[model samples]
Target: MTAWDQVLELLGSPLMQRALLAAVLVGAAAPVVGTFLVQRRMALLGDGIGHVALTGVALGWLVGSWAGLVPQDTLALPGAVVAAVVGSIVIELVRERGRTSGDLALALMFYGGIAGGVLLIKLAGGTNANLISYLFGSISTVSTADLWWTAALAVLVLGVGVGLRTALFAVSHDEEFARASGLPVRLLSMLVATIAALTVTIAMRVVGLLLVSALMIVPVAIAQLFARSFNRTMTLASVIGVVVSVAGLVLTYWQDIPPGATIVVLAIGVYAVAATLQPVLRRPPPPQDPHPDMVDDVLLVDDVDDADGATVRRPSPTT
Candidate 1:
């Protein structure tokens, strides 16, 4: 068969459809929450959460064997979600309490989670090979059930991440100010961590646990180069995520490369290209400390903006 015929044949396959849908959902959802993470200077939060989620996967596997569950892989995602949520909360609590340093807490979480996962898997009569797929991703093996889980979780992530963007932004921008404004900063911080955990779980199937944070952060990094406003950066990052995801899947179909690795490489390539061109393509400076009334609309949120005017008045903590 000719190359075009092979391409058409591959496109017509059912597996490709499932893979594409899962990829798009994951791609679109990851950056939504990632935007807030980047803004909060917690870009690596996803990585830490992903590492912790490994324990959940093994827990599910071990329990599934004990409970006679028919499909073990199906349980792993939910388990990862649960583990990730707990890990996120623990990390936040540690950071909030001021006793343990944040990085130290994350380091402990990393070692404990990964080690626990491996031990659990081995105790369950599994081996390192069982984890290879979860660590590096096995998108091609994503089943129909996995797709449904991805879609539902993706929607939840997008809704929470984007629906509460303003409030989330306020908290991420400045916790003390947000708290003073009665915006329920603590709850919002937890919510951000929850959304980030969900992002890690969902992306696990698409990009694997080890590389998930790259998907969460790289697109935002790329958008930072040219985005003139906070909203634009999110939009650009999300679009880049979706584009690279779909493109990576298609490229892997023909190139026989690992989809997760390819997708991450493509995103990084885009970032590199954008960075190289950033100087010549320089945009206007981010709106400088917009009027108090205009903070949410144009304060230009980036890794860390010093705009003192940034604040949100609606959706008071009581609300």
Candidate 2:
């Protein structure tokens, strides 16, 4: 069969359909929250939440094994979601209460989260291999239930992140001013963290926990190469996120590579290319009409008519 034929056959399958849908949902959703996180100088926040969510995965497995509830992995979704949200809130609270020690707190929390996840999963009778899937994602294994959960969570994240763009922007840009202006700065801050947590979980199935921050940050960086305004940057980043994600997924099918890694690598590649070409792609300022006052301390000769009908104002280059 031809390569296109094989590609068509692959896309026709139920598994590919679901994977594509999930990838699209995650790709579109991640940057919505990421934009806010980037603005808040919390780019690594998604990675921390992802680490904490691993513990939730283990909790779900433990509960399922004990209660004969859905398969050990079935509850991983809700478990991860709850864990991420709680972890995000905890970090936000810590940063608020321990301003001088915030970096120490985040580092402690980050390492603790990873260690907790590993230990908890081991106790649940799972091995390193099981966590590997969550760590790096197993896109091929995203079930129908995961699809529904991803869709619901992605919608919630996109809705909240975009709907409250103005408020979030205000909070991210100037917290003290926002509070003085009657915006709930504290609540908004926590909400940003919560939204980032949700985004981390939402991407878990497609990009894995470890590499989630790349998807959240790199796209914004790529967009910022050209975008001058915050809203434009977010919108363009969302578009770049989806394009790179979907393109990476398609490449996985074509090349038989790891989806999460492929997605992230593609994002980085695009960024590299964009960064290289940014200077070339940038438009030079439009030539302005030269006026005498455009230069400071220039003694102008009144409109001197040269040979041509044009009047010329001579400029002194000296400051």
Highest lDDT: give the candidate number.
Answer: 1
lDDT (Cα, tens digit) per residue for candidate 2, span 125-149: 8787889999998888988988998
Give a tens-digit lDDT track for model 1, residues 229-253: 8889999999999999999999988
Error of 2 at 96 (Å): 2.0
Evaluate model 2: give its lDDT.
0.87
Listed in order, each prediction's TM-score against the native is: 0.86, 0.89
Once fitted onto the true fold, the runs of candidate 1 whose alpha carbons sit more than 4 angstroms away are 1-7, 283-319
lDDT of each: 0.88, 0.87
Off by over 4 Å in 2: 1-4, 286-319
**Candidate 2 positional error at 285, Å:** 3.4
Mind sharing the TM-score for model 2? 0.89
